[model samples]
Target: MTTTQDISQLYPNALWNWFAQICAIPHPSKYEAKLSAHIQQWAAEKGLPVVVDHVGNLIIRKAATAGMENCKTVVIQAHLDMVPQKNADKQHDFVLDAIEPRIDGEWVKANGTTLGADNGIGMASALAILGADDIPHGPLEVLLTVDEEAGMTGAFGLQAGMLNAEILINTDSEQEGEIYMGCAGGVDAEIRLPLSTENTPSGLRQYTLYISGLKGGHSGVNIHLGRGNANKLLARFLAGHANELGIRISDISGGTLRNAIPREAQCRFLIAPEQVTLLNQRIAQYEQILNSELRQTEPALKVRVEESDTQADKVLSLSAQTRWINLLNACPNGVIRMSDDIPGVTETSLNLGVISIENGHGRALCLIRSLIDTGREQVESMLTSLSDIAGAEISLSGCYPGWKPDTSSPVMKIVKDTYESIYHKEPDIMVIHAGLECGLFKKHYPELDMVSIGPTIRFPHGPDEMVNIKTVGQYWELLLAVLARIPQKTA
Candidate 1:
């Protein structure tokens, strides 16, 4: 047996072992077959009732132990999929490989790829509770949904009348101290720009304008942080000089994920050799302006302009390049509005997530998120109008509803009481901007009162993802306390 630097010593005995075993599985989004099966097998081994839905969601129900029979059943929910993101140089296949997670004191992180600690830790907690007989609790049902990252396919496909639990605890929140009661609804707008090119002007030199090194993050959750969008910024520069420098584009590319803010974007094209000096001067001026704008949030923003390997024969058609710049400049990025109800919260936002030029087609993707339906519609409608103007093919997907918070729930009072009893302090209750499965789950079980909580995680949906080992214990304790306090049904 190969033991690759164990970190089981960091967590409590049972949970430590459970998390370690979970880290050994490769459960990337849309590729959760093995992980789902492993969960089913574990349930079978424990002699629990386990069922796999049509979409591979595994729901395992453990009957109430002797004394806890009368207590209400509590659903512990978490996704089984992980985001598969790695650094530009790392070469690990998420579909066929497991994360090599390591412990840095109290923080547990992966080597180079994303740790999947976001939901994996939550799943591990649920499994540990289900597997152990020592933990004190009421009747428990674990709902392990698949493909949460790419889309909430499992949550969407959940059959009616499937769950008996009237109260749910979603252990997917990233922050440790606060409880998330709501989240913004989101949708992805995909625009494919048709490409048609012409010949390059002779005597023009080829150059590559590159931008990289900005800390990209979740478009919805971190959009208000003032992080720079490389695609939009790059377009600003190109639009400023497209005609002045006789610039022509060959190709344009940017960020990877639709849910993440674009950190880097690059464009290759030809410009007059004599105008290179002028271009350099303009680039420096733009860099200063952008740096000043993003100083607080994206301090490490970088831009590089270099000479390209062109045989003096290839260059983008002037007409195509012109249209591309027009579209890029027209596309919207950043927070659209501030919430009127919740002070200091962004009510609506859009991220110009991706751009690609390939095979005579230039495509762009934008993500729009909002707590209010009208705000979401406004931004999406604007994108559709832009697509029509640019003559680009457009599509949208991954639409999800917002989880409107119920401040007067009886379950909320129970949870607050439990927390106060355990820690002697009030837990901060707020809503998050990131997408969560609770919204969809509530659609199926409207009577269900749900609240989400979890350990502190940093840099989620990115390669530097890490979960605080200490907070896991506190979160576990809180969940168990809530479960134990559920009102018993009188026979």
Candidate 2:
């Protein structure tokens, strides 16, 4: 029940005000029209030149400071859309309702919903920089891409001649001290399994097997934390007891975004009345086992089996159910390999982010990410091979290239030196496992120098998303320092 007035009291008035305005306007992925218009109007009000690309990407240009006219143009980039996720019991409409922001000690969070701060804060920072008169900078262009969460449509369709900035500063990284020079590329794998149904067996009771309370997070950023996947968990339970308990699944579904770890799942299935006790016992046993395995990361995990009053006249054929469960169990859902080049960084990973069954068919959508093309291809092939054996059709889409790191770049050196000078300590210059727009930008502008940085945000793409208040101030300062020190363009 937090209000805008409460959130507006936070530090850095210009940045928070812009972010608050952004949150007030619902800007979920693929539905960014309103927020896009808001940006255009705001830019116009400031008298800055603005252009909207065909794909809804926004570019607002600011003239150079008096003495900094000789420096190269720097592009401040951020996504315009956000992942819309909320708690199970929260009654919120993402398309029409504004996110309720609250101050939680040292962080800003939404009430039972994902705070759009993943890129909203970054976007707000860019806007603040554009509107500020005190800050010194070279030519500035703010590139706000669209649909970066659910899809990279804007990045994929970015026109080459639209942006003229030689240096791109992507303000989308989550951690404060980490400067991200590169990030993993990704592809989406879709598996479709044809379903076979039969009449519900007489004397069989329909029940719902529910999996919830898992602390699902951004699949790429938190995949290594060993959090449970609800789709996999529910499928595993059904697979383990399908034969013994005579389980006939009628419908199965869970998760939404392909980039977020599934936190909840449920399935309707028919079982003999005699097996009800055994079903409850199995759920209890699995809950204990899962809790023990993921106690540190997913301490609130719950697996519930409840009797449902609704009845189904049809259920999936036993063979179809078996195949479905087996395939879900066989699919990989976590970090596949760690980086040999970057110690402690994930080199290859897969997130079984969404699953749904309808109209005699089921589909599993997964997001595969890797720092190298070979790693991405290997994972894709593995998924296709698994789908082939399970008699399911597989397809891949939205394959984006990874940004190769350049440690010796002038921009990288400038940012690093600026951070060390300000903090009196070395910041971690690392490559992220998450997919970023920098990869796409590199392809369009191969000669452009780029780096990604942002405030500390935790649990993005989920209800627990929050941004650290203190880190925002530090991030703002560092950005200002980096802009002031951008070397003059050479002949």
Candidate 3:
């Protein structure tokens, strides 16, 4: 894998240079100390005022250029961390290793991990604007937040009085021309079930059920895509075998993050020896059935079950395992409602993103999203009650409010006009299903006017993630136009 430094000679633009430098540091959420230090060092070198918050968020401000002092102060915001995920075969460590980003024609991507371009581009744009003393601009502050992927910890932990910008330009959306006016609030619920075990029957055999190759994505945005949830499917198989073959689970694990649909899952357990041939036949039948069921959306789905080393000790007692399997099967995943306000938009969705059996206990993690607060609460309550009924202890965290759309704001108009003037067409303005830091920022700065825009990015939060190289220039032009056209603030 070639590091960013090795490609600097080939693509040497200042914006790309900045991105490459950031890529050299491993900045996974909550593990962003090194990346934050780099930003602080850059700010000190430029003689800019930099503040380091308790959660590692860094805000660096620069004085307005000579003639732009009277212009309103604006904050360019982006998260400093990226989701740490990769191909199962990849050997990179997200905490101590740098991402090896590569350029493919007009796109930039990582070798086998997510390209941090989702927010790396935002960071690069801020750096480019701040460093360009010759570029036309106004008083500016760049807020680089940490732990955005894991929980928005940086924004959640923001101090009472840390910022002064009255206008925020969030460069975190993926669509280049579209302006994200609002976003959905989200919460993660973790369900844990106690364990009990039973001795294995003699002449029984162990089998591992494996599901992989499904196209997993951000649970909120892609839940409606009908992507296969391997955890749920695996549980269904185990439940079906509970009475027929005397299946007792040894271990079950799937999905790494709470916000991503499970692409792969594997379950190891013991089954009656006489049923080995019968189970193999059933596995083949299930692989075919799943293929047919998910063929339209998850064409690459694969399901296989094979014999594995039997654990000396059972993972879940018979009773506990039965309840756990029942809970997994009962939990819902995928789109729950379509937007009544916007035609063809998904209004609410759910994802059973993670399941694990650890230390003889089982835990399930799920994420639910909705544009309407009432609907979100409805779904969350359902999951809570369901977990309780299953006798599993439930905990919810990382809840953040949504950004209500403001279609008539002056800042919103300015961004729209800028895009029309530059692109010669109207840009789409819509609300996203995923969470953004803008909502949290609004809590602290209620009077702050905000609009989010960014270059085109695809498959964010996954290893196939990439950013459009050409759109970067177009987005930069639009941002500059918006700055130049900023109306004088009312006293």
Candidate 4:
């Protein structure tokens, strides 16, 4: 596969060149040390001061350009990690391979995997600014936080006294014309249920039920799109047919990241030799039903039953199977409620994004998001009740508060006015439904003013992810203009 595909030849060579370098490194969440260290060395070569925080975040600072020293210190921020998601047929390893970006029509995408353009462009923009001595800007600081995809470890571990900036421009938002002033808070729920297995009956054949080809996206941003969740689909099939087909599941697993909607799932089970024929017929019938039900959202959904070559002498106990099926059905996996306050905005949502059942244990990882504390709490309350009745243990962690909108904020005003002047039109100023680290930054640096901007990226955190070519240029120009117009610092 072509690694770079001439993206470095795109407009703004300085920015695209940096992005090219980033694509060459593997920087998935929890595995960003290489990329972080690479950037530190790169910064040192540029003669810029670099600071490494205890949480593995990189802070690179540069002095003001000539006359712009009087302007307020501006911080450009972007997360260094990208979500690792790929199609079942794809062989690329996110932690060992370079993202091969290819230009298709007016957008740039990858070869059967996520393009990582959601925040790669943002990081490139910051690096570009830092590399240029001609671009007029105030005292500049580039904050590259690690592990923003799977978790917000860097942001959560950020110390208050580390930053001396008055304004923060987050390059993590997806829309080019949209200015994100606030974002939802989120928490991850990990549900665990102990399992027991029984000896498999003789003359039983092994079969693996597979579900794939569904478009799984960012759990938060695409939850409202009504995409099919592969885990939920697997549960639906097993719950409906386990007893009828006399299936004894040996192993069941689906999804990958807790923050990403699962695109594929599979269940390995044993069935009687005579029932195999009936099971095939039923699978065909069920596949038809699922396709019809999800025709609009999941046209390419595939459900198949394959004979497994691996031998199994054990299967989940009948009681364990029942408990697992019931919990899967009872669990909340999509949008719970839309915001009554903000029209068309999601208020609270849950995604049962990942699950694994094997080795005498079953685990389900879910992510819950909400704009307000109470809304998130409401969903948590439901999960609490579900766990109580399901005889399982549920734990919530990585909880972070939401970034509340500040319409009267001076930084908000500056961004709005600057966009209007540059584009000659009003930009969409709104709060994002997804989680952004701006919320954590607000909690840690209450005195800092923040806003988010980025190029138009589609299907982020999925194999179908892509970035629009034209908007990259537009976003870059707007970012430069915003920096030039940073308000003068005052007491």
Using TM-score, rank the candidates from best to worst: 2, 4, 3, 1
The lowest-lDDT stretch of 10 consecutive residues in candidate 3 is 5-14
Higher-ranked by TM-score: 1 or 2:
2
What's the lDDT for residue 447 in model 3? 84
**In model 1, where do residues sit more than 4 Å from their true spots?**
1-5, 200-205, 310-316
lDDT of 2 by residue, 312-398 (tens): 989888888888899999999899999999999999999999999966788999999999999999999999899989999999999
**What's the C-alpha lDDT at position 367 in model 4?**
94
lDDT for 233 (candidate 4): 93
Error of 1 at 75 (Å): 1.1
TM-scores of the candidates are 0.93, 0.99, 0.95, 0.98
lDDT of 4 by residue, 1-491 (tens): 44484888898788888888888899888888888888898899999999999988999999999888889999999999999998888999888998889888888898898989978999999999999978999999999998899889989989988888989999999987889888999999988988888898788889999999899998888889999999999999888889999998889899999989999999999999999989999899989999999999999999999998876988889999899888987898899999887787898999998899745678999999999999899998999899888888999999999999988888778778888998999999878888899989987799888999999999999999999989999899988888888878786
Off by over 4 Å in 2: none
- Highest-TM-score candidate: 2
lDDT of 4: 0.90
lDDT of 3 by residue, 138-249 (tens): 7788999988888998878876678887789999888888898988888888888888776765666778889888778777667777778889888888888766777777
Q: Per-prediction count of colliding residue pairs?
A: 1, 0, 2, 0
CA lDDT, every prediction? 0.83, 0.92, 0.83, 0.90
Pick by lDDT: 2 or 3, better one: 2
**Per-candidate RMSD vs. true structure?**
2.6, 1.0, 1.9, 1.2
Off by over 4 Å in 4: 1-5
